[model samples]
Target: MKIAIVGTRGIPNHYGGFEQFADFLSQGLVQKGHDITVYSSKNHPYKESDYNGVKILHKYDPEDKIGTAGQFIYDLLCMADARKRGFDIIYLLGYTSSSVWQRILIKKSIVVTNMDGLEWMRSKYSKQVQRFLKYAEKLATKYSDHLVADSIGIQSYLKKTYNAESFYIPYGSHVFSEPNKEDLIAYGVTAYNYDILIARFEPENNIEMILEAFSKSSTSRKLLLIGNFKHTDFGIRMARLYGEDTRICFLGPIYNQVALNNLRYFSNLYYHGHSVGGTNPSLLEAMGSSSLICYHNNDFNRTIVGNDGFPFDNYNGLKEIIEGKRKEDFFHFLTENIEKIKNIYSWQRIVDRYEDYFLSIIPKS
Candidate 1:
């Protein structure tokens, strides 16, 4: 099958979730002998045309100069290019800026869109932008041949709200087996002695709330934050408010996958405060890394973690959990999560699911 993937920045995964998905999924498909072409941004560091047997098509991305509005242009460029390619499947990763131009998508290709989290619910966007995102969601639903929801909650919402059926295929992660205690030395932390929270320093991610909760706790353990917090206004404010605390360490964004996995594996507690996303990749990664997880209490999160994690709704709840009794052993939760990673959310399993789904929809020639 000739597949073209659109809607992410690029393949080498310089960015977040969707890029990582594209990187892993495209390579996996290629391994299965499928012809895959991933649309990458011109700005991506990877200048090569091919990555690990997968074809990379670099399109002009003006987001750096024109800001967020540039994404619409970038999407348009990708869609225009895709229309000319005789692809069996044109997978749209998200609908944020591309759905508005859905009319231009190739009619011969079976258009399948991954309906990301409810962007309208994000606190970072203004009311006007939220309205636009809602409209985009509608466009994406109406125009695409099929829809994919990364979480059960998202699937249910699509059915309830749009009366539309969607495939529930969550994100995937690899279990971290190589745990090096030396990896912790560079970060100035010891194994299983510090707590960590990795997320974008955005309002909806509950970054400040998690930091506050950690601050309120009396434990001498360090609270290490991993994200780009210096750029945004809210993040700057958070830095000022919590910077004075000696125990809180603001470790900026670390994109290296092995480093991140090592951090999660060695951390005492991994905090996921992302309340808006569906089947978040980071959450899956924490599980795969065998971190004793504490996630934001929501359907999207609960669907993945199930009974294997500590759920916290607010700072007070999280603070109590932090200060509460320590378990003699957290082997049960850790083992259960690891098993889930191996059985359900592993990269191989996820790739197989995607392949089966695609084959089911696209008739054999």
Candidate 2:
């Protein structure tokens, strides 16, 4: 099988979820004796032509140069190349940019899109941008040959809204066990000593609410926030809001997987405040590391975490969990989460499923 993965920064996953999925899925498919090509942004730090046996194609991404408008140009350029290449399948990771070119995508290849989270419903986008995103969702649905829902919640939305049938394939994780203790030294916290939270510092992610709860709590455990704190106004304000508190440590973006896994592996508690997203990669990572998760209560999150993890809505809810008594069932929650990753959410299983799906839908030529 030959596959072209479009609409992402590309392999080695320097970006977020989709990038990570592309890196893992492409490499996994290659190992299974499939030909794989991944489109990467020109600005990606990994300047190599190949990554882990998969071919890499660089597309001009002017996000740094022209901001959000550059993504539209980049997706167009990628799809144009994809249409010409004639791969067995063109897998699109998201629809925000690619849906604009839906007419050209028809009959090019078996185009499958992962209908990620409720993008149009996010509060961060202006009403106008949200309307356009909704249109993009419709356009993407109209053109794609198949759809994948990362969570059951997403699957339900696709059905209820568009009456579309989508394959359910949640994100996977690697069970990280061995971590070098030295990785946590520079961060000035011991293993299982600090509470950790990682998010984009956006409104939809509920970073403000998490920070508010953490601030109000009088816990001895330190709070470690991992993200590009200087990227947005909310982040800057959050930093300054809690800057004076010595207990809150604003550790900037740590992309290194080993170091990140160490943080999750050693965390006494992990907070996932993202109110929007489908089977978030970070949550999977926490589960893979067997870190106890405190996720925001939502259908998307609940489906992934099940009853094995904690859930909360507002600061008051989270504050009580943070400062209040640790449930006797918490240990059982940890065990179940570990079992969930091993059995249901392993990356190998996910990769195999993706291959099966692609093969099942490939035109009988």
Candidate 3:
């Protein structure tokens, strides 16, 4: 089947979770012999003529900024071109006003959108942007032929908010091989010497709270925070505040897969402070690496890790966990849960689920 994936910054996944999801699924689907096309931002320099058996179409819009508005414009252009390309299905990763327009323009196309976390609920957006997103989300749910939610929590939200039923397909992760001793020396750290947190340094991620709590803790483990320094004003401020600390190392975004995997694999523990978003990629990656998990939201983290890891709602809770004030059977639980995660969240399994869903939607000839 010919398929077109829309509503992402594009492939190779140097950015966020949705982009990574798009990259992995598109490649996986291509391997399954489906004709796939990924609409990418023209501004992204990695636009190759072709990528791993999938076609890449670069949409150029210079007026676009890196926000919701920019994405809407890019999606408009992509939808117009995709309609002309006559794809059997248009798989959208997120919602936008342009998606509403796409539904109007392409009546026969099968629309499938993955409503990735509650974006408008995040504190990072301005009030006006949030209002726009809420409306767009309504249009997306009302119009799309199929919807996918990345986590059970997100699926529940969709049903509660829009009374819409969606397929639940969690993200995937792969365990990292141990890095070479020489490579570990380059980072000036021995294996398992530090705790790691990888996320966009936004307020919703609760980065400040994590930093404050970790800094006050008595744990001897060093803390390494990796994320894009320029993603937000909060990121810049936090980098300046935490970068100077001896125990805390603020390494700007490390995009190399080998380096990131090694860092995660070798970490003593993984800290995830995102109070929003469904099934975060970093958390899954850390789990795949068999790192001990301590995260922010009780409901969100527990949904993924069960009782295998620690959950904290505030700075005090985080500190207590770090200082060993709250000790449970986390390690044993973690070991057992790893098997569950390995079985459920493999990329091949996730892509197969997607393929099954897509085929179920296609009309009989």
Give the best candidate by TM-score: 1
Candidate 1 lDDT for residue 135: 97
Candidate 2 C-alpha lDDT tens digits along 81-149: 998997999999999999888578789788999999889988868899999999999988888999999
**Candidate 1: regions farther than 4 A off:** 325-328
Q: Which regions of candidate 2 fall more than 4 Å away from where they truly are?
A: 325-329
RMSD of each: 1.1, 1.4, 2.3
The predicted structure with the larger lDDT, 1 or 3, is: 1
* Clash number by candidate, in order: 0, 0, 0
Name the lDDT value of residue 287 in candidate 3.
80
Q: What is the C-alpha local distance difference test score of candidate 3? A: 0.80
Against the reference, the lDDT scores of all candidates come to: 0.91, 0.88, 0.80
Q: List the residue pairs that clash in candidate 1.
A: none
Please write out the lDDT profile of model 1 over residues 60-120, one tens digit for every residue.
9999999999999999999888988889999999999999988887476889999999988
Error of 1 at 274 (Å): 0.8
Error of 2 at 226 (Å): 0.3
The full ranking of all candidates by TM-score, starting with the best, is 1, 2, 3
User: Which tens-of-lDDT digit does each residue in 1-365 have in candidate 3?
Assistant: 99999888788786788789888999999999999999888987686969999899999754455554576677889888888877899988888545567565447688888888778888877899889888888888888888889889989989998999999998887755565545556577777777889988789888899899888888877888888767789988987887777888887788877777777767777888887768888888888776778888655667988777778889888888877732233567556556756688878888998899889889979
Ranking by lDDT: 1, 2, 3
